[model samples]
Structure formats: structure tokens, C-alpha cells
Target: MQLVEDDKYGWSAKPSSCEKGHAPKEISVDFDEVYKSIILPAINLINGTNLGIKIDCTRGEDLLDGGNIVSQFLQKICQAEITITDVTGFNSNVIFEYGIRLSVRDSLNILLCHEGVKLPLDFAEQRFKTYHMGLGGGNDAKDYIVETIRHALPLLLAEKSVESVENLFRRTVENATGRTQERRLMEVFEPAPDLLVRLLNALNTICSEANAPGDKKVFRLDPKLRDETWKLLEEIGKTMENSSNLSRAIELYELLTKLEGFREKRRDVFYNLNKLCSANPDFKEKAQFFLERGIELED
Candidate 1:
């Protein structure tokens, strides 16, 4: 589509200022590049895991303009029912709206199995109270106002439920304190069997959607969440000896490789290749092949 060319919809009105040597800036319509660079890579990760996302994009010339462009690509071109809304004054910040109902279900299952997960009650309550009071709680809430109690309530529940599970982790880690706070925190609160099952199921769904024919677009996962997921899978494979655990690690590695264009950390892939091959003898040949291939590419 070009500024001068008319689409079936209609040609874009020429800038009136262009008559005075003032031309409207040309916008690149590389929605395909955006999908390949941004959306499709994330979808690849989802393919390796069973996770559903409700991405709410804020409205603005800066955000909605670009968002609409992406949205049109996803909705019209990709033909996926990715919910996009125009909440008043919603800035361009992205929110990872993990389903609270889903979290509550996982929590109930964890309790039923008597499985130990960190689920921190205090942290959950604090998060709940913040949301209940219509205060900002989600990663995106810092920018947007809490409009309705209805919107805030489910968020509070989910935050608290996840926190309750997180608390159990805090107790486990109370003894070990060190420089790798993030890594240490994760090591403390391993996912219960139920949570792992839920995550695996979600990943399966994402992978199916991604590999489905007609359009194989990428679904983006939250960076922190994605890291945590890969960590959880690696831990599970090491400690639990579950087959799905190793499979997920491999799938996530493939997704990360596909995202090479968006990232600068090339060595992480080689590091994971070493760990993955060492951990699973079954994957040794494939891992070795890729490792050699990477060296050749580097050379």
C-alpha cells in the first residue's frame, strides 16, 4: 500500500501542506516484518508451552497507531482473535493479564495434592489489598488508572493466589541469601505438580496454535515469565526425571533461537546447548549437530 496508490478501501487523502513543499512522512507498512520480528517469535515460545494471553493495548497515536497497525495485521492478515480494546486514556504499555481464575484453580489443586509451593500469603494479601483499594498492582497498572472494581477484583484475586504460592518458596529460601537474588528466589519456590501440568497444557495449546497451517505466526511471552518458564522446565527435568520437562526445555530453546534477531545474547544459546545435551543423552546427537552448526556460522 502506498500513499499515492488507492486501495479497494480508498486512497489516503493527500496532505494539504504538501502543496507548500510540506510532505507527510511516509510510513513503512512492513506488518510482515513486525510479525516476523515481534509477534511470530513470541508465538513460537507459546508453541513450546501451554499459555494463553489477553494482551490489552492502550490507545494513543503513538501506541494505538502502531498497535492498530499490528492489530490489523494480526486480526485481518493473521486472523486470530487477539482481543484489542480502546480503554480511555490507556497508554501503550502492555499488560500480561494472567487469568486469576486459572491461578485460583492451580492453587486449589496444589492444596489438594498437599504439594508444597511457596505461595506467600502475606505478599498475596498485600497485592490483593492494593488492587482492592483500586491501587496499581499489575505491571501495567503503574501507568493507567484502576477504572472499575470489577476489573480490579479479579486482578487482586490472581495476584494474591500467585503470591500465596510464592510465600511457600520464601520459607524454603529463608536460609540461603546471596548475590543471585533472582536465581535464588526462583530456586526456592519450585512449581507444584499441578502448576507444572497446567503450564505444560498451556504450552501445548500455544504450540498447536503456532504450528497450525495457513499462518504460522509467533506469540510473544513476557520476558521475565519466559525466563522463569525455561528455568522451571530445566529444574523439573533435572529433579523430577519427567520426559515432558526435557521436551519443554528443547522447545523453549528452539523458540529462543528463532528470536535471535530480537536479542543480543548469543552465548546463552551455546550455554543451553551444552547443558541440554549434558542433561539428556537422548538429545546429545541433535544438540551436538546444532552446536557444530553454530560454530560454522560464527566462523
Candidate 2:
């Protein structure tokens, strides 16, 4: 197979006789040499080994057979198992196709770019591999490409879907709205401290039962619910501490130590607990316990 330059589309593979009757893995690139030097060699390394799959590297133009180019290109972008787009030059068509792929799939979409090229703001947060196209840089670029694909293959094979750029934005928005709603609900329950305490206890019980050894059908909690509950407890605990309600703050912080969620924050909880308990002469033993636990966590 040879990569040939087209006046209309930058570069596309001229399918050889041996390249027929296999699945096509599309790579969208702006430069002809990028396909020949970097992409082709990396793809050869991947296909040469027994990785349980073969990649027939092609571009959108290669799939054209006397049909509407746009329609065929969109179809390939949507259906391909892996879509690699080289955004070195930030080509408009390449970016557009990549956007379409991001909207449809949650994984196996890769972006490659020349080193030091800043991507658009929308794609800035998205993970991409960069390589230098200078002298003696081709080998480095090829190796990086192979490594990127190698890391991605496990997730693909395990059928674990990654978060797409579109989904990430949606999740961000949803989480913000949920937080606002939670704050409003807390405000309504703040006047009735007993009700708030009962609600916190109920959330803790749900978190405990979810992890307890028993029938899966009998007790289960949504992971989001568990996370939100922990966040609420932490927020309320800090609020009580700031308000000098040390007894209530200590109670909440102690509850956090018993819960499974937010293990990373436990050391900070212990530190706060120790500080609170140290103030009262009656809580010297509890203060020592918290201090020892906090010191242990540092190791």
C-alpha cells in the first residue's frame, strides 16, 4: 500500500492488491509525509504482531467510490472502530470530522498533532498525542503513536467506555445543577436540626448497607448518591466547625471516618477532629486517638 497525495484531499492510501478484504482503520491527516513516515510505520508495527486484530489504514478519501464524499466520510467516521485524526495544521475538515466522532463515540478516538501546536479551546482539555516532525523525529513520532494505541487497546477490548468530550461537558453541567439543588435542600432543612441529622444518618446507613455483605438485590446505593452524601457531610462538618459548634462538627467528622467514600480526606478529618477534641479536657483520650491516626496516615 502507498500513500498518494490528492489535490482535493491532502493524502490518502492507494489500496494495493494485498490490502483488500480486511477491516479499514481510518486515519485523518493533513500532510502526505505524515502518512508515509509516521502513521504508516506505526501501523506496520501494530499489524505485524499477533495482537488479535489487523489494521488496514485508510483515509476518508480512500473510501470514495463514485458517491457523495461528505456522506461516505461521515459514515466512515461514525462506524470505524478507531478514528485517528492528525490535527497538526488544525485543518477545518479534519476538525469537523473529529467533532462528529467525539459526539457519537465514547472511546477509541485519538488526536495526533505536531509538537507545540495549540488546539482550539473546545478541544484543549481532550487528551491528544503530540510529536515533532523535524529531522530524526519520525521514529519518535511513530513510537509515540504505537504507545498511544497500545494503551487504548485494553479499554477497547474490556468494553469499558471512556468519557467522551461531549459527555464530559454534559456531566459538568449536571453536577453544577445538582450541587445547587442540594444547597437549596440543605437550606430548607437547616432550621430543623433534628430532621437534618436524621437525613444525614439515613444517607450514612444507605452507604453502609450498600457495601455490607448480603444479597445484592436487598441493598444497593447509586455511586452518585454515595459521593453526594459524602460531599454533603464534609461541607456540613466544616460549616459546623467554622461556627464553633465543635460537638456537632466532631460527630460529623467521626461519621466520615466510618464511611468508605473519600478515603483521601480522612487524614484531614482526623486533623480537624484532633484539633476539636484537644480543646476540651474531657476529650483528651479521643484527641490522642485522632492524633495517632493522623500521624499513621502520613506514612
Candidate 3:
């Protein structure tokens, strides 16, 4: 929707002194080029990360201005979790607005400029990315920014959950030790089994017991929790095997076989799946395929 001058943050009067002349200097509303070059591409990269990532950004000029809007505008700028500033063309307004953002936040900001543009001297100590446009360059600097942001987004999202200063510092130090440390933790951390896994486990038990023809049903004595979990899986598999419910057995085995995190036990999963395949003709080909896949992975 187009912004109107009557809004809470928009100005209805003439341009403020800071916005006119060399200040609010006429901006090149090359929005299509801007979206094509940077914003849309960065967004797609972030969304593609598969980390349940969400990100959106808008240019400040696209929104309304005026009224007590200056304060509202500066407040919104201050509240922004991350701010990206480009000093392309040495635009005075861009520089001034960036200064305002830094006044509210020091870190969580990135600066960029088109190649060959003059960077201001006062911000000399800070690092900024230089983007190249047009033919000679095989790569754009915005790609570097996008890549860096994509890499950093997960770590930043992980940090958002930290509730205490000490724990946050510890995570920061771990991060300082290596960039991959946070990712490693994410990879190895065990997620709680979803409802489907739990439901399937119960169904496996019921179907297994239902298979016996002659004898009165008797639920066998199972040991209470052991400190070792894999042994428990083995025991459970053996108990369920007595009833010969091949479909349930195959489903359970398939879960283990498909998981990337399963290390040595995956081979055992394939063996059990192939063994059960004999009892169910429907599963035989699928079992053979996965068994071959497992073998290929090993070799």
C-alpha cells in the first residue's frame, strides 16, 4: 500500500531542512534494480537455508514520513535488529542516516559501498564491503554479503534464545574458538521424538501381539530402563520379532536406516530390514533397494 502524509510517522509539511538540498537529496528510486541486485537475492538465499529461517527488509524511503514521524522513524531505526547501510555514491543522507543507526546500535550492522566510491574518513577504522557492478566482475560483492549473512544468521538466531549474560558469553567464546562450533552442536543435539514415532511404537506392540494364533496372549516381562539405550532398542526389537509383524518391523527398521545421524547401527538396521522383507512381498524390493543403498554408502 502507498504511504499517505497523514499517518502517525509521516510529515505533511515541506521537506525538513535535513532532507532538502544536498541532504534529502533526490534518491534514485531504482527499486527494481535494487531488488534485482541485492534484496531479493539475499532473501532467497536466507529462505533456502532450511533452518526455518525467515528474513525481510525494506528501504527506509519506501515508508511514510512526517508528523512526529522523525522520532518514530529514528525509533524504528533504533529498534531494527540488523541494519545494512550502503555508502554508494557518497550520498550525504545515507551517511547521516547510518550515523543515526550507529548512535542506537554499534554491532549487528554491516556497511557496504560500490567500488571506487569515496569512503568517509571518520569511519576509517571500520571495515566495509566493496561491491562491483557491470561486466568485468564475475562475482558481485553483494554475494559476499549474502553469503556472510547466511552463515551468520543461524548463529545469531541461536543466540536469541540465550537468557543470561554468562551463558551468552560462554556461547560467544565457543563461537570465537571456531565458526563451526555452533553448527556442530546443532547437528548433534538430539531432537525429541515426534508424535508419529511414539504412535508407531505403540502400534508395533499391538500388531506384534495380535499375530499369535494358538496360545493365550501373554505380554512378556521386559526389563526396566537401562542406562544404555541401544541395548534397549535391541531388546525391544527381539521382543517384537516373536510376533512376526513384518510391516511394523520394516517401518521401525526403515526409520533407523534412513537417519543420517545413525553411525555403526545403520548396518544392523539394513540387516533387520532385509530379514523382515521375506515375510512381506510388498516390502521385498524396497528392502533390497535400501540394502543396496546402505552397501553403496559403506563402500
Candidate 4:
């Protein structure tokens, strides 16, 4: 299959002679300027000589047959070899499509977002790659994203088996008895203390490098590592809250609110801080500040 330009849709696949017998490998994407200029170019670079692979993005206008749009979307999500979702701005339709892909497929569902865009609470724990649209004339951002996808694609394709969220829930319900169910749920949310410690160390190292002088300064991290760190921090804050260590939880969340790349739009952090601060008499004013900030970010 080869990528063919269209007058209406931005890109689609045209089957080549070699792909006549076998089904073409497909990568489904949520189309936007970022995907058109950055993501697609990166994929093309890494997809060299792999003409059987096709990139697909469905536009609303493409559903001209009077078929239900939702049905068509669901079919695309289920059929694609991989789905790359752009979750920026927390668009409800995109989030719904992403959820469908996650529930049905265990792996090869990648989320991409703009740097500093706050995701919804339910999806804050999900791993996503972020790209900077304005950093270093955009080339650095594109290069970083390209390298990330290049490294990830091979590993994702090599996986022999994977577990979907639906399957996990089904398994849990099948095997869990009342108390065990609670414990299982807790286990899913809470990472081991050792893992938390390691994540903390990694964050510290990144920060230190970022702060280092001149040529050594690391402005941003690998997108995967950055997502992992954000998730870890959020989890640690929640763990502290569960243990009744509200002060520590507040501290952790506050730290997130001060961290670069996160401080601007981390609504979850501000929301948690607002809740935690409201519980303490001394922080009433701070609580209101956080609440207002969170509302601003939400808007």
C-alpha cells in the first residue's frame, strides 16, 4: 500500500501490487495540523520501504453513505492495527474514540497531545506522548517526536500478547470476592513504595539536568518518561491522601503545580490542592486560589 493524496481527505492508502493478496498494515490517526506536518512525516521516515503499511484518518465528511458516524468510527477503531489519538483540548469525541480503542485493544493505542494540555481525570493516569509546537523553531520538537515513535513502534509490534482493560475488568470480577475485590482495586492504583521512590529519584535527576548550566541544560524529557513521571506523581499524591497524610499529598500536588510544562495546565493537581487545602483551616485562602485556578484551566 502507498500513501495517496486526495482532494478531500488529507491522506489515504492506495493498494500497490505487492499488497494484493494480504490485508494492508494500517495506522489510524486523529487528523490535525500536527499530524499532517509532524506526526505523518515522522511515520514516513520510519516506514521506509514498508509500502504495505497505510495511514488512515477519517473525516466527518467521509461518511457520505448515510451510515451512522459512531458505527463507522467504532469499526475503524476495532479494525486498525494501531490507533494514534490526539487528546489535546480534551475533545469529547476524541476521548470517546480513545476509550473505545483502549477497551478493545490491549496495545498499539498511542495518545499524543500538545505540551501542557490538561487531560481529564479519568485519563490522567493513561500514558501519552506530548509534542511541543513552538519549541526551538519546531524542528527539535518534530525530531524528538519522530525518535520516540521510531523507538516505540518496533517494541509495540513485537509483543506476542496483550491484555485489554475490558478483559482485566472481567478477570477481576470473575476471580474477586468482596474483600479481594477492594484489595485488587487498590493494588491497581497503588504502586509499591520502592517504585515510588525510584520514580521520585528519576524526577529529581531530570530536574537537576534541566537546571544545569548552559549546554548541559535539558529542556524536556522523552515523552514516555515525562508521561510516566506525571502519572507517578499523581499516584503518589493519591496514595498519601488514602493514608490520611493530607499534608504530604498537598505538598506533592503543589509541587506538580510548580513544575515546568505541568504548572500551566495541570487541572488535576490544582483540583486536588483545592480539596486538600480546604480541609486545613490555615489554608482557606489558598484553597480558594487553587479552586479559581483550576476553574480557569478548565475553561
Candidate 5:
């Protein structure tokens, strides 16, 4: 929330004019001063790629559409196609938003560390791009961060426009059910990851073993049990994913794909599983196995 004292980055200025019929490449930034310094640098980096991905940037404050400020910030993080977060300071709000972004979309974020700041041990093995805001490297630090991002985000430079993971996830979930059904489906989200996963997989296993071909129209789980299972799966998937346990999240999602009322959510499950395959090679093969099984069930 701490922005650099600059007029150009829109901290104290009004939002910029929108370009007609043009959807410029955009990324949400987490912290301010360091974030502000990188704005121009990121634009130059994208332009230098000759990839036509002009950069537009925003922090939490820029999204004030008269909604609750906290909710707006969470929504922006949830919705950003790509989010660049400066973990350099370990700001609590920044960390919170970063967690939200991870749960919403696994592979669409770039972690940034400051020159001398110590990072959390949990993400020690995680790769973070380093920058030196007002430190020795200064603008050169921004240059390093941008360059590092471009390499990790090679998809951004591809020939065609790339869809955001958030947009794709939303579309998948929406395609699985309508607005009201989606709301009802998302309501069972208790946040205790282990417990939630336990309950979901327990119920999921029962549904799987109990399910039979040409039996009833479907294996009818108790209505309450069905709703609560999906709800728990949703929160568990997010908690595991945010903890960098993509494989575990994959297991939870795979189980969700087997539940009776959740057949329609198979694509949503696949969407998450596919995103995670990049983290572990075996996940792709595992995903293929689930795809084949789920498809056979439909047939």
C-alpha cells in the first residue's frame, strides 16, 4: 500500500485514459515504491522484446470502484492475469494478496525480493527475481527484475495474445455451472486444509467405490454430503496450492472429479491439474489417466 512519491505512476493522479478497442497487457503490482520504480522499466522491457505487449500496471488502490477496500484488493489479486509481488519487505498485506493470487491461479505470478532483505524460509527453494529499489543498483535493479520475468514468462512473448490463468479458470468454472449454481457450489469452503481434504477424499472414495455403470441415473450422495464435499475440496485445493503443494492439490482435485454431483466440475478440476503439471512431469501422465477415466464415465 506504500506507494512511491511520484506523479507518473498514478498513486496521487487520476486513472489514465483508456485506449479504444485496445486491450493492453496488464499486471497487478503488490507493494508501492519498489513497484512504482519498476513500472517504466517493465514497459521498456516488454517493448524491447518486440512482442507488442505494452504494459499497464495497477496496485490495490487503483481499483477503488466504491466497494469495500479489502474486498476490492482481494478481487484484484483474484482477477489479475499476471501479478508481480515484491516480497522484499514481507509486508503482510502483500503476502496475503500473493497467497490469494496463488490459490486463484498457480503459475501466473513473479516473486520479487529486495537486494538485502531476508526472505521467508518456507519459499527458500522457490526462485525469486531480485531488485534494488533505492539500493546500489537502483534502476539497474529494476532492469534485472524485468529481464528475469521475461524469461520465466516466455508465454507473454508468444505470437498470439495469451489468456490469463484467472480468465481461463473463471470460464471453466462458469461453463461447469450457472451463476446461482456456482454460488451454491462454492459455499462449503471451510479453510482447514488437512481436515477438508480428509472429509472430501473420504466422501469421494465412498462415491467412487459405490458408483456403478447402468445403476441409477447417478450414484446419489446425500444432498448435504454432496454440497459439503465440493466446498471442502475448494478450500483444500487453494490451501495446498498456496503452500506450493501442487501435487497434493492435484490429488484433491482428482478426487473431486469422481464425486456424483461434481461431474460437471471435471473441467475445472482438469484446468487446475493441467496448470500444475508444469511443476512435476509425472502430473501430466497422471492428469491423462484422470482424463481418460472421467471421459469413459461420461460415455
Candidate 6:
């Protein structure tokens, strides 16, 4: 992604930073210079990348709001597909930050375009799916997904060359399943306490519904399924409120957690159980048992 910042007001080119006093005049000049030079080039460069553009107009300050002009320029570049994310703040050079993002995006686009290799639409969709839903929230997930795509795309395309879509689908399904499993495990270790009960109920309804069979066989309920499902339900049972539906949440959480394979999250089971036990009086004894077992494992 590459980012370019144009401060038409020339608010940036002045020496006002040295003088302890604010000079509206210097700020005005800097704004003008930026408006003339910076905005046009950025608009011209938008067509090459898929990530699209994010324009920030906060730097224009008091003189002239550069948003309308910049936006018109962007429209000229790519009429529909170009994404314009605008942000406003009192910061002197808002464009610079956006410029950096554009730069990195430009580099990726250059690679994809230069490779002259058009990935099938399905490949693109799969990559996006992994990015938006499966990737980590903070940093690890984003880095991992990008790096994985960089490494995996070439192999996936090359291997599927001249092959049927079914072949590609089979190969891709494994990776997707693995991703789903990893996400499931994360849920077990770090259950979204606020949404877990609701989400679990939803899962159970889907699993047990008449439509859950055949096409919905994605969960693959079998011997392994039953065991994992039971464990998840047991976990939920240990923490559930008296008013909560025991069957639905327990069944759903168990099935979903088991299917996703939370190997890394196994240890967290007791930690969460302790919290659950603390929340409900009935589970105090069960929680203590798990808590003691967890401590022993740590020791």
C-alpha cells in the first residue's frame, strides 16, 4: 500500500513550527501549495490497487476545505470501485498518514498486476474471507493473513492450473476448514462472554434444524462430533445461568468448539470454568475441581 499526502494550503511548507507564535498567513500559503501539487497525483493512481483509497481532509484547516475538490478528482480516477474513507482532525498533515497506507497498497498492487497472473475470482473471494472473518483483531491475524496469501496464492494458482473447479474447491476446503477450526479454538479459550450464549444458541438451532442435514453437513456430526459436542455442552452446563436454556447453548457451544479444534485453548478451559463457577452458585464444586486440575497442570 502506498500513500501520498498533498497539503494544498501549504500549511506544512512554512517555518511556523520554529516561531512560538501561530501565523495564520504561513498556514494559508502551505495549504495552497499542497492543493496544487498533492491532490491530483493521488487521484490518478487509484485504479491499480484493490484496497482502494482513503482520503483525509483535516489538513486544509481554515482556508479552503479540500474535500470536495479531492473527492471530485478521485471520482474522475475510478468512478465506482474506488473507496473513499475520509477523516477530519486538527492535525497539520493528515495526508501523510494516508499516503503511507497508499504506498504499501500500491506495492502489493504492483506485484499482483506485474505477475500478469489473474487469480480466479474464487481464489480472491477465499483470500478475502480468510482476511475479514478469520484473521486476528490486533496485529497477529492481519500479518498472518497477508503473509499467508503472499505465500499461498502462487502455489494455489499453479497447482490448480488446467484443473476443474471441483479440484480447486477440494484443495481450498481443507484450508478453509483449518481456518474455521483455528477460530473455533480461539472462541473456546476466549469466549465472547457477552455474545457466547446467544451465538451458541444460534449454532444449536442450526445444527438440529431439519435443514441441518445434507447440505448443512458442514459440521459433520459423527462419533468425533458427538464427543466434542458433549464436551462443549458440559463446559456450557458448568457456567450456564438457571434461566438459560441448558440444551441449546450447551449443545451449540460444544459442537462449535469441538468442530473448530481449540488445541491451544485447552488450558483455558479451567480458567473460564472458574469464572463461570463464580458467576453461578450451583457450579462452585465443579468449578473448584477444574480449577484445581488447571493449577496442577500449571505446576
> Per-residue CA lDDT of candidate 1, range 137-235, in tens?
222321122222224324433332122333332332233453233223233234643243233334545655667678667665445555665566556
Per-residue CA lDDT of model 5 for 1-299, tens digit only, reads: 11122111111111122211111223222334454566555645665676434445666556634423443355445544456665654556556656656665554466666555656687656776665534444466566656755674454332222223223223333443464322223333323322332343355455545564555454545566556665665555544433335554555566566666666666655655554563466566765765565565553
lDDT of 2 by residue, 1-299 (tens): 21111101112222222232111233323366667788888878987877776666777546524323444455445445566677665666567667666676745666766666666787778777666556766687678767877777665555522223222222332343364332333443344433443444455466556666777544333456555555555555445433334455565556556655546567877887787677677678989999999999996
The alpha-carbon lDDT assigned to residue 129 of candidate 4 equals 66
Q: Give candidate 6 misplaced runs (Cα > 4 Å).
A: 1-260, 296-299
Q: Pick out the ten consecutive residues of candidate 1 with the lowest summed lDDT.
A: 6-15
Provide the clash count, candidate 6: 29
Candidate lDDT scores, in order, read 0.33, 0.56, 0.45, 0.51, 0.48, 0.34
Worst 10 residues of 5 by lDDT: 6-15
Clashing residue pairs in all predictions, respectively, total 26, 0, 6, 0, 0, 29
Report how far residue 165 has shifted in candidate 6, in Å.
30
Using TM-score, give the best candidate's number.
2
User: Local error of candidate 5 at 241, Å?
Assistant: 34
TM-scores of all predicted structures: 0.30, 0.42, 0.40, 0.37, 0.41, 0.20
What lDDT tens digits, residue by residue, belong to model 6 across residues 55-141?
A: 222222322322233322221222111122212112243334333324322211111110122334633332221111112311332
- Pull out the clashing pairs in model 2: none
Q: Which residue runs of candidate 3 sit more than 4 Å off their true CA positions?
A: 1-32, 64-67, 136-138, 158-299
Instruction: Give the candidate number with the greatest lDDT.
Output: 2
Off by over 4 Å in 1: 1-226, 233-237, 240-244, 260-263, 297-299
